[model samples]
Target: MGAAVSDTSTRTTPEHEASRTPSPPGGRSRLAALGRAVARRRLLVLLLTLVVVAIAAALGGDVAQRLSSGGFTDPKSESSKAERFLADRFKSGVPNLVLVARAPGSVDAPSASAAGRELTERVAKAPGVLSAGSYWTMPGAAPLRSRDGRSALVLVRLGGSEDDFRATAKRLVPKVGGRQGVLDVSVTGSAQVSVEIEKRSEEDLAKAEAITAPATLLILLVVFGSAVAAALPLAVGLLSVLGTFLVLRLLSAVTSVSVFSTNITTALGLGLAIDYSLFVVTRYREELASGRDVTEAIAQTVRTAGRTVLFSSVTVALSLAGLLVFPLYFLRSFAYAGMAVVALAAVGAVVVLPALLALLGRRIDAWNINRALRRLVPHRRERGPATEESGFWHWLATAVMRRPVLFALAVVAVLVTLGLPFIRASFGITDDRELPASAPAHVAAQALRDDFDSGESSALSVVLPETDADAGRVGSFAARMSALPGVFRVDAATGSYVNGRQVAQPGPAAVRFRAPGATWMSVVPSVEPYSDAGTRLVQRLRGAPGAPGTVLVGGQAALLVDTRDALAAGLPWTGLIIAGTTLVLLFLFTGSLLIPLKAVVFNLLSLSATFGAMVYVFQDGHLQWLVGDFTVTGLLDISMPVLMFCVAFGLSMDYEVFLLSRIREVYMETGDNTRAVALGLERTGRLVSAAALLFATVMAAFATSGLTLLKLLGVGLALAVIMDATVVRGLLVPAVMRLAGRANWWAPKPLRRLHERLGLKEA
Candidate 1:
């Protein structure tokens, strides 16, 4: 031991000696020191902020191209597998273009038929179309023409995934969809609808941002009572948004980012930057109001409010990171966008905003736009912590404390009742219904479903493992499928069979079903697509007894089944990961296990109410007139609610962190649980509501978008945030903490020891 110690002593050098010395203090201590340093070098910090914004602007322009349009299903599922086989072997892809050709009188009239056939021939020879066929050419095909005979359909299969197909489809639209001989033409299908959804979403994202910006600026002006103070958070929001785009651009080089992620990136970045900046700026002004000098106030504010922003951001980021457990890129991409936004927003609040504060000094309140408004309330100063004016929050807290059990029971009842709609939620993939009724794709799809006995888009394609000389087994499989309760008909290379009756011999319609080593069968549905009956038929087809491993199902119905199962399978584990980490993080912040657990329960209650309202309004069509052109599918898309839960949970916990941190701060200083809860409620109550209102407003603007799914996200999140601020934070939190008493800070002795050694706190 003596020799080893002597050798170690000899090996230590100047750099090693410095590295081995006691590490600098961390958390609030380190932040306090850094805040002082930044105050001393305010100009340098300002320049650094400018540099970050400039670099982000340079890189962010190309981010749109990197994001993809589709990621709603598991790529490894049976549906995807079947599509792969069909595409590769059959030289077949899902029909990506549809032409709804209409005539003045009747489709079979000489003038209309000549025009329709001419359009079909021209489309068949179009650059991207591998094949095109219409009711004009296919005699006696009832499914190809409308019941009234005034309109007929033309289906085209387009291969290759690039601008070639979209560009070609657009060109065909003007030529074929316009006047073609005596008929009028309109086009919609898989590719055209996908294009429209992308275009509309991009426009909506821009519109949401446009509305949010001026509104956020105006709200901030009122909150801070001065243009200069208000501009600080807005500045942070802009920088954070640009920075998030650059981060996404970098991520794109490694993986395909979804365009949907961009919408989230902007929305969350704007809200969170304002939130963190509001907290910090509020604290800084408080220190100044108490007569601290500029440097002291900036340092103190960073130490406390800055620290709170750090923890709040961590909790939010971790909540999103839990989404990484799912296999879908759509969920994982959100994790990417969310974490980047939170990190950038937090950094701007702590580093850049503080430096600006030090430079501005008393000028932080320059350009007082609300001077007249301020006169309405005497003794008005923009203090960070609450004053005598916060009596409302204090009085409410006292009332809740007096009857904690009753308040808790009442809140729980409302939350539970609200979540009842989710019990029967029907999960479907996004379709024409996601678009507004005015969308051409939506109109065309509606016409097709209404007029035709069977729309090809809804037909389930079943692929057999082998293309057989054994025509006997092929006929047998077709017989078995056609006899099922919901099967409209089964068409295959063997023949065309309807309800177990041979309607037609093998013909041109069955040509696409033949391929080397694999043959496919199309099972048309008698029930409404995406309904429970349709899903059951898909399940039965997949479970067809004779060929356990030989069959694969692909279609809209199959896609939903696979997607629903995939989401369901990952959900429990996702919940566990999020809940577990949230518990740990909150415990580290508050040094109390019970407090973290209470937070989770309360968050769920608030989210349940939001979900309940979603069902009542969007799913049940209760407020149809409020949001125009809503076509209620009597169900929700599978992805939207999951996406909402992930985003809303993080945001809800953001408020939770703010409320709990304030309460814990007071409790630590005073050592009186009741006084702590009251004081904490008093301080954070107005701030939480203001922040919630601003964020909810940003979300509500998105609800104005034309799409049903976009409307669902907007309304659901806005309602959730409002509920958290008013009901959960104001009433439920205080009531529960009052009931829990000192137990709110309790921990196991071992955990208490661990927290003592390594725990976080606001200054």
Candidate 2:
């Protein structure tokens, strides 16, 4: 049998191994064949990837055109119904812009009239503006009256879809700002919102490079202790990001890709590249120190560290793929873009990196110096053997393990307490004032609100037919709607003659309304805009009577109302999908049910804490200064929480795989959970921390972008990663595993058999 094994191994590599060994082995032959295969075909794979990306890019313009032509069409959705009704009655969509004019202090009669007239003239001539008029000057418009009479608003209707409006606004903003006596000018419309999202995404990409590149370099310098070694990971990471962008640009042609997708893809790719490269390079150094030749060290690194990286990358890609369960187009694009970036980074690490290492050999470490500076900064290997565990980490693990039940209970209690704020969570798309106080949009929005009827720039309309024009019928409908509680006022255009004719006009509309920023509605109990309560109100209004016609309710409040409902309805299913997928992947990787269960539990805990912190800072108005100037509108965006959940869960699982892969390797070899946990943490902790910090810093740079939504996402994600790396991964992970002991690796006998048959072996 031994002679046969030797003969089998030598068959593929007789010339190469004949001088080094007496006999070849099967494992050696198989590995040699695999290496040769990869070496032979690498150029083809790379060229194929580039070709695919180029094809996709070529198709993107057509895809964008199709998406732009498909305007808002969800009539069944509450907001869509309102939009349709408004379109039919007014022969137009919602006003595209709200232009504000403020008096020196407060608006007097003369100032109000002058401001309104001037705004009308200036806005009407504004480029890209189809029509601009003052609501205060229009007949039968009572909602435009401001209590203090200090502000006036000009409503500008633009021609086109949201994207068109955005393109128009980008050209119009500078011109609007140039107008005389315009204390502040802001274009707040759907188009402006899209523009802002795109602008912020670009800014985030720039900031990510600024932060991630430097942070990654610093980390490499610390780990490899050589300038060349430190620079290699950054180079690989940059290449991965560039390749990812080219691919995404191509995918955008055939699919609806979110503006935010590029930023997210770049961040994920850079992080993984740094992490995977760190693992391989570190292992290669170890092999070199053990007196292995350059080619041998590269081969050993590929066989061991490269396999770990492949498994880790596969697990992460699967986790991100869970985002497909979300119905939102943006999220689906995020999943595609994120998964592609991660896969590419993995390939770069395992294939491109190995080829480079093979070609560079000992030259990779040639930058090492033995001068005074070098003495002051010892190399990673020179610092000490990794077998020695720090007293701090050891004590922490022991204390938690000593009182396993208490530690577990304490963690759960803390997480639950933090999560309480989310129970009453509300979401909405806020006015421009939600931006920092210094932002032009915020200043303009506040000025508009202060000078006009708070609702002048905002109103809730219920469209009813002009045929119901009798005093009794109009009075009854108006009284019923107004008295429905929370209804501020109801204006029915009764007894009015159009073109001097008294004939009942079926298309003539009746508008019912409420106070600006009111939290209540007749159809549902008083609830904040975009909250579950408000969404329910929208549903009730849609079902309400309008005699011969349907009543559609819409406004900023209504859009938020619908968005919240959609998110809430979808959240439970999304959570289940993510959790289920993560569990399956963990079981497949570790061949243990307990580890996956533990991972899920801890991930939830980390997520809960993250949400609580978001509420405390963004909602409850804590740490306002540290986070930058943001107005607390007492509500969060409904989509923010769902987006955060998907992102945070995936990232937490990413670190879990990194830490646990090392632990599992040790466990398989020694069957000692405690020793494995300790040693694994010690070995992987620095790299994990570095990776987390790089990501956090990249995200944190967005806080300065002057976009509230992007800033919120950045701050929220940065906090989650910091907490996960330090609190969850560093402390809680080891503690729980030590307590679970042998049971953590337990699997049923049948499952073990399955694992043996199908399990992936370490390369």
**TM-score winner among the candidates?**
1
RMSD of model 1, in Å? 8.4
**TM-score of each model, in listed order:** 0.92, 0.80
Q: After superposition, how far is residue 127 of candidate 1 from its true place, in Å?
A: 4.1
Residue ranges of candidate 1 with Cα displaced over 4 Å: 1-24, 137-142, 160-175, 370-390
lDDT of 2 by residue, 579-626 (tens): 787777777667777989999888888888889878888877788778
Clashes of each: 0, 8
Worst 10 residues of 2 by lDDT: 1-10
Total clashes in model 2, counting residue pairs 3 or more apart in sequence or in different chains: 8
List candidate 2 stretches off by more than 4 Å. Answer: 1-76, 84-90, 102-132, 143-150, 173-187, 193-197, 204-208, 290-292, 369-386, 389-407, 461-479, 491-540, 543-547
Q: Give the clashing residue pairs of candidate 1, or none.
A: none
Residue 153, model 1: Cα distance from true site in angstroms: 1.8
**Candidate lDDT values, in order:** 0.80, 0.62
